[model samples]
Target: MTIHRAHIAGAALASALSMTSSANAQALEYQNTSGGSVTVYGQLNFGYLNFDDGESTTDEIVDNDNSPSRVGMALVQPFGDNQLRFRFETALGLRSSSGISQTEVPDGIDWDRTNIRHFDFAWANPNYGTISLGQGSMATDGVTGADDSGTDVISNVSVSDIAGSFAFRDSTGALTGVELSDAFSTFDGGRRGRIRWDSPEVANFTFSVAHGTEILDEDADTDYTDLAVRYGNDFGDFNVNAALGARRIQPSGSDDEDYVIGSVAVHHAPTGLSFAVAAGSEDGGGDYYYAKLGYARDFFAVGTTAFSIDYYEGDDINGAGTSSDSVGFSVVQSLDSANSEIFATYREYSYSDGTATSYQDANATMIGARWKF
Candidate 1:
């Protein structure tokens, strides 16, 4: 077996253009690069950005020229019998902190030591099974994350306007500045760990199920658990996947927050990608959802290099009665493995009420080259 120390999802990087590669779920891939015990590759991003809050009074240059460059490095190590038999991946990166107040945390330009971005390990074999440990995505989900929202895609706010986008909340009047607590948002960083199993493929179809555990309570000795089932397959021309996920945040808690999320996607060869989305109410609060339409294609050479473009849309969150809808776009290309490429992004956030403009409206535009290895 073999092992490597590198996290997946490099697609989250701001600007690097290439057909996304699949993480080796069954083997080690770093050995394909230099043919040694370890392999390394990363993105060194330099961006030139202009952010405007609809009014010129709030325009600011965000990155690249004078902005602190973002850098990351990852190493992969593989060992054991089956190659996929044993492996470890870890990544270290530098991040600039930003929040409601720049002074809430530190002054500016700092590297975090106590914070961990990525740390996880997995073991699997066709004959046996697979188990993962540490902080990672829930076993019941796919890559429906914000990064894969494609390009220029909006937030889930607008989707709230859909037929069933609103939920039960006491948010009648426009409330700004006074943010919603973790109860309203899905990003509460609670305790999370996952376990799952996959049945070998029959034809092009595979069946999978996963269960996740979260320490929702320490004082009461209770935790959250989520269960999910998925069906996936690929035809000659396209690949299709669907999943049903449900989370029981805390069975013993008073709120008993439980929600369900279902996703389906069909990606055709060199271009089209389509996805269906549905989110159910937690503890029978209500329901909301969204659908996405997108396509990707490569283009002509400009000044001796190739360029590409990607576009997507659709966002809904907070239901139709509350605020939280946004649409955004980003275009990135490589200037060279060690250089940069041009980039520009835009997003129009709309809300059920006038509060949408304050919480989501903004457009970002930029042009410059980036560098990395």
Candidate 2:
């Protein structure tokens, strides 16, 4: 297995693209005067999502709700036992949403495009490990996650993906008048502008650390530090992966806060059975719990067919005594021949306030297809 000490999604897409020698989707590779080469690769994925606010529902196309749709390039140069690498990547919002709008596009311009997602440099030595800098994931990013469920491409209990576009109905069946806030979970902390380091694995254990600032406002008087430890091993037919991480944020004009998160997942390859659990808490007044169980089988000629159920509960978000509960189920079918997948999911979300009064609830259903090149 190839070890990816960089961005998780990047590594996955790169691996998928590397297997295809198709003339239509070929990666541009160049050999430099030095012992080095550069490769350009990317993937595009989109889905149609329908969200219900109890009284009404709307459907729209969205991008990266599951597997992100992006394009990127990488440069690698070998120096004896060590290597130097650089990567540049950006995402496509695809659909017009609050986060990205097409209305402002200049006439004659088909697309205005989004900003770069990943721009980083790294140095790696098999014996000494790797160090990276720039806009990318922190060491603790995804460290609180342990989902072996194939449905992750469609649903993983992260409510924000679909909930953002719809409103939630209060207990009395009244609209909150605002878009439902994204689901809360410890499975957050995506990419950021940071410096990170990964230590070589020893006895199936590896360590990582990072310091970074929020992506949008780097100059904000806020700074964050993240640290994590990871474990992976195979015992007979059982494969296990576990991670623990902690983060401290010193926010501008606010009291400092810290958080701890951990997760473990186990899978039986021969039987196609898997399970995972995760929990986390913040120093102030917030906590979350998540669990998922699933199975995968080669029921189709194309690839494996998988299904899973996931649950999440979060409390006192940002010290507001706001709580959320979400339950989701999904089915995913992979088409190996085309390097793509078809998935469908159903989710129910509930929210409450500090007084234990029901705040809102909503439902979402999505059907989508994704392809990686």
93-150: candidate 2 lDDT, tens digit per residue: 4552223211122221123323567788999999879999998888888876777878
Residue range with the least summed lDDT across 10 consecutive positions in model 2: 100-109
- Pairs in clash, predicted candidate 2: none
The TM-score of predicted model 2 comes to 0.84
List lDDT for all candidates, in order: 0.38, 0.72
Those runs of model 1 whose alpha carbons end farther than 4 Å from true positions after fitting are 1-37, 45-51, 54-109, 113-115, 141-175, 178-199, 202-224, 229-232, 251-254, 270-281, 302-320, 334-342, 352-373
lDDT of 1 by residue, 75-140 (tens): 333344322322222223223211211113223334443233234455655555555555445544
- All candidates: CA RMSD in angstroms? 9.6, 6.3
Per-candidate TM-score against the hidden true structure: 0.58, 0.84
After superposition, the stretches of candidate 2 with alpha carbons farther than 4 Å from their true spots are: 1-35, 96-115, 177-183, 215-219, 318-320
